[model samples]
Target: MRVQEIPIREIRRPLYRQNDQNKVKALMESIQEIGLQEPIDVLEVDGQYYGFSGCHRYEACTRLGHETIRCNVRRAPRAVLKMHLA
Candidate 1:
């Protein structure tokens, strides 16, 4: 799979609830300085990709005006992962 630009709105996990603003900010800064070292994990369902992790990274990329992200796609039954996320 290749890295592609996906809309920020498509990011499924919420970034603000982690209560690690300072750390998140620092990580974002680092990502901006050195670029994303790790691609976020995501799963495709019904033709759309939903993030399973890296919510902070997603937010950081959005703030940095990134239109797309490098993602590691995992193919699985949505019901199983949805339960995991829930």
Candidate 2:
């Protein structure tokens, strides 16, 4: 895995997840104070990025108007991506 900053618009979230507003608000404050402590995990397939976790953090950053997010990138095959989608 490699850590990098990726454009939020470039990463596709395949699953619809509901994040807690309180948690997101807290995270937004923490991120604003200290920045993101941990990078979100993402899968890279065919040059495309997909996010499967970190829903709360993602929402927090998005609400904070962040254009890019830090991610732990793992390159995977289309089959793996299909498995995630499934």
Candidate 3:
């Protein structure tokens, strides 16, 4: 496993729409003030990243003009991917 500062444009979320704008704004403020306490979860396939969680954080980072983000990468069984859908 490795941690790297990835570009915001390279990150992708399976979900098409985003909700909770206010909450996301709040999180953005918090992150701006105190930095990202928790790294976002992601899965990489064929050199592409898919967000498993932290959709709001991703948006916040983008809004804050963050060039990169902290991400955790690991190898998981295919079942984990299915479970993410549920």
lDDT of 2: 0.97
Which lDDT value does model 2 have at 1? 93
Mark the 10 consecutive residues where model 3 has the least summed lDDT.
73-82
* Candidate-wise lDDT, in order: 0.73, 0.97, 0.81
Each prediction's TM-score against the native?
0.74, 0.98, 0.78
Badly placed stretches (over 4 Å) of model 1 are: 1-5, 14-16
Ranking by lDDT: 2, 3, 1
Error of 2 at 53 (Å): 0.1
- Cand. 3 TM to true fold: 0.78
Writing each residue's lDDT as its tens digit, candidate 1 over 49-73 gives 7775787787788777888787876
List where candidate 3 sits over 4 angstroms from the true fold.
76-86
Task: Name the weakest run of 10 consecutive residues (lDDT summed) in model 1.
Answer: 11-20
